[model samples]
Target chain A: MPRDGTATRTRILDAAEHLVIENGYAATSVDQVLSRSGSSKGAFFHHFSSKQQLARALVDRYVEGDLAQLEGSLEATAHLTDPAERAVAIVRHFEDLGDEIMAAQSNCLYVAVLTERQLVDDGTSDEIVRAVETWRVRIAEVLKEALAATGAHDVDADALADHLFVTFEGAYLLCRSTGDSRHMRTQLATFRRLLQSLLGPTT
Target chain B: MPRDGTATRTRILDAAEHLVIENGYAATSVDQVLSRSGSSKGAFFHHFSSKQQLARALVDRYVEGDLAQLEGSLEATAHLTDPAERAVAIVRHFEDLGDEIMAAQSNCLYVAVLTERQLVDDGTSDEIVRAVETWRVRIAEVLKEALAATGAHDVDADALADHLFVTFEGAYLLCRSTGDSRHMRTQLATFRRLLQSLLGPTT
Candidate 1:
């Protein structure tokens, strides 16, 4: 209700995201968030009633951002007439975003929640599952269209589609463990090159 | 040490592993491990001086098992003369173990400790980094040989090697979120097929 309410909410969410990513949601407390965000107890409670509420809000924010990126990539590649090139373009689009993604912790929050699913409520958990499925299904459709155009019956479209998600998530995890920022870009580039070869001249 | 000391230690480790995987390391307490393992505080203390010791021990035990499996796969495929075939066979070896892996929580411990590295000791964190590097370097060597044999200069051996790790960790995370056990095997199979295509006709 205050003039600075929106700024205060954004600060809390930003601070909470970093803490949740660094420490699991269960290990992170509202007090820690408040201290990190430099907000008072009144402001914290005003923004989120409970830690559980904060968890849901964090996940909702993350899932929205992820889906927006996915949609933006799809929309960017939608104009390509050849479905094969379209699919390849989508992979390239992600490859281009690899540096930013890696720099921002690379979906670590989504994955942290995923590994710590037992700690969160069902609604928060479902939001994650739904986001994963959205990527899987949407990408699979593009690959299916590509395969149809290429007459490539040797590969299952869904499996190939899932490869993109697998590589993205896996490379980020590797980046975290190894501290190798190049893993994301190089891995995605490898996938894009392979996808192009598999599509084969777009006949 | 008591006569049943070994069994007690095993029980503590098993319970700790499950709890640490389900909830991140920071969230799981020493008391929870004791309760879950049906062991007394005396027994837990007897096995591990503190929770930190248990964390290192867990990673040690897990790394041993993972390396053993990796080595076992390499040994099984050593008879294959073609390095490219050997590499593909190694992936197939893992594909056969997919069911057991998915059943046993699919490397969630490694990824969990990785995400929660801040909560772990330098020794434990180093152990995880070393284990990942071990997999990456060993597999990269084999892939390098395969590429040399096939005269394929387009692909980076390290990138291809990293793909296996990426696909693996990513697919497991997907499995956790989506409840799709098939992602592991299907993604690996797809990687193997694509890998074989890339390595085409070993000269």
Candidate 2:
């Protein structure tokens, strides 16, 4: 793809994601996305064959960006050899995400997309499921490493990872509905405490 | 409300709610609702002046029904004078709700409604916020009683209540996305364990 072509593609995807989050996928039309992106119909057609294709691209971009961010956060703590410290670092990264969510005017795009997945095609829905699984596995790897480093014998890393992921989503819903970031902060703190307790004295 | 008239109104509301959950607030049209409901345009107009009105009524009905169910669950455990028992009973009630959510084969109405609230009116959004607060306060009261009973002064009843609420919403999201109810069961179990740990030995 040419540079401008890539730029236009990104612009269109950005507009679609924003509109989908604001008005929902079913209500957001291609025309609206074009209008919002200030791109011509020809450009959109050149980039994506159809609205469904556009949706798929949007989710793909979302997942890629999400994973990249998670990897970047983990990489920031790569120098730390201790698993417990790395685990704490992971929690800290999520806390930063919670802050970003609170500061952002809208709810998470993945959440909106997931809620409206019934209206979307199976490919799109499968992408979302895979995205979630990918997140779970990535987080679990760090937690498992932390457990190994700490010599913790009793903890279930997979279950704990799922618990953390679910709680984070729950906190997002609460924060979005209540229009209060304090709840998110408190929930993160509680999870941090739980982790600390489980790990036993975060050295 | 006359008997037949009330029945018609309920029929319309039920259809609207179902459509909204399956689709979304923005995508679900009055026409679709009418067609599914087998109700006439005149009846829809008579029951609700506009689509917005119908949406409002749907949310109002959801909140009312939700509060009633919650109160009923709390009342069921009213006989338990011990605060710890009451707290545990409350968790069990939520577990039952998790079961109901799983069995429903769709996401929670409130979750859908809240996600779509940004597209709805401010009044609708405020109603959702209030409904969430009502749930939190009611659950917190029970947790507070348990804290007092057990002399467990360390736990913040309000925060814990919010956690439970957030976790429930998150669990709903997870279950809806994965098409699996086991994640919800696990989240609930983790919450129960947290409560047990805080309350100290469920006796």
Candidate 3:
């Protein structure tokens, strides 16, 4: 069994995530979180000083988890010398990420917060922005490497990387509006093909 | 000058739209709208029955305005018989749309509402969903015509249309997050090129 402190924190976060996604952040109350998490008021205050701090922690934890997943995918493809193959692997990882989001039946938490960014504190908004910028830079580096390996000198790797991330964001929005996963799947396939087209013939 | 009734309604919507986008739906109150719009309680109630009704009217007006803009672009391109040219014209129209959105300095209200869909009622949610579906169908019809004209029968016009809409949504999200219009401009260019690549060289 998990330690008491760790268990309480996880429970609080789980309840917060569900509630925040289910209701707007402004409408969600500390009382609701405490009741949903089944934690004492003292315990709740012990872990988080305020709701804003809790939000910041939630965003930070989500970013860490996402970056770790990305790192694992990159490492798994490290042995491959072909940059195009590595890039394709990274794209596949994103597809898997989409699948996971669909399975969870939740909009991206970062996106959820971003939509209501005006209502969030400046610190929380800054953290979310930085996390997105980090993702773009990391993916751009991968695309740059792939472009170098494939001799696809005409393509702008930075722009392409931004496109990749933006398209995913768009795909997620479509899925949420339509109640369909096919939107994401089809867009990702189109993106994969677009990436593949930038490569020279497979050796 | 516009009629008093027409003028008052527009004033109220302008105020509510600004507040809703600046703050959020839950946070923006009827009192705030009335204060911002400089309309009396009787005038406001005469036009909108409730906050929900005001939101619905705002969304409906926005959608109608958008569809009119799209129709104007399509009409401008009606003389171009070449499918590729027509497709490219449609894309250019979207680029202009991005520019307009950036100039306005507001995220799409539909998207803003979509992010907070869980907090809203079914009627509001249904209206948002229907607006998006309308865009998809209209764009798909254009793509279908293009495909038929070019004999690019292999392309899935429906999926491609959905991609176009999804990319726009994504680009808007990026711009909102980064506070940079360049993000939308670059992604729209990439999408335009993607559409061009689907066509054979201009005959």
Cα TM-score per model: 0.94, 0.88, 0.90
Show where candidate 1 strays beyond 4 Å: A1-3, A119-121, A201-203, B1-3, B201-203
Candidate 1: pairs in clash: none
Q: How should the candidates be ordered by DockQ, best one leading?
A: 1, 3, 2
**Best candidate per DockQ, number?**
1
For residues B7-53, write the lDDT of model 3, one tens digit per residue: 99999999998887766677688999999999999999999998888
Give candidate 2 regions above 4 Å deviation.
A77-85, A117-121, A142-156, A197-203, B79-85, B117-120, B145-156, B201-203
Off by over 4 Å in 3: A119-121, A148-154, A198-203, B118-121, B145-155, B200-203
lDDT of 2 by residue, A77-170 (tens): 7887888777777777676666665675455666677666454446576766776787788778888877787665555676677776677778
Distance (Å) between predicted and true CA of B93, model 2? 2.3
Better of 1 and 2 by DockQ: 1
* Candidate of highest TM-score: 1
DockQ of 3: 0.53
Worst 10 residues of 3 chain A by lDDT: A194-203
Top candidate when judged by lDDT against the true structure: 1
Q: Cα lDDT of model 3 overall?
A: 0.74
lDDT of 1 by residue, B38-146 (tens): 9999888877888888998998998888888888988999899888899999999998878778888744687787777464436576776787888878888888989
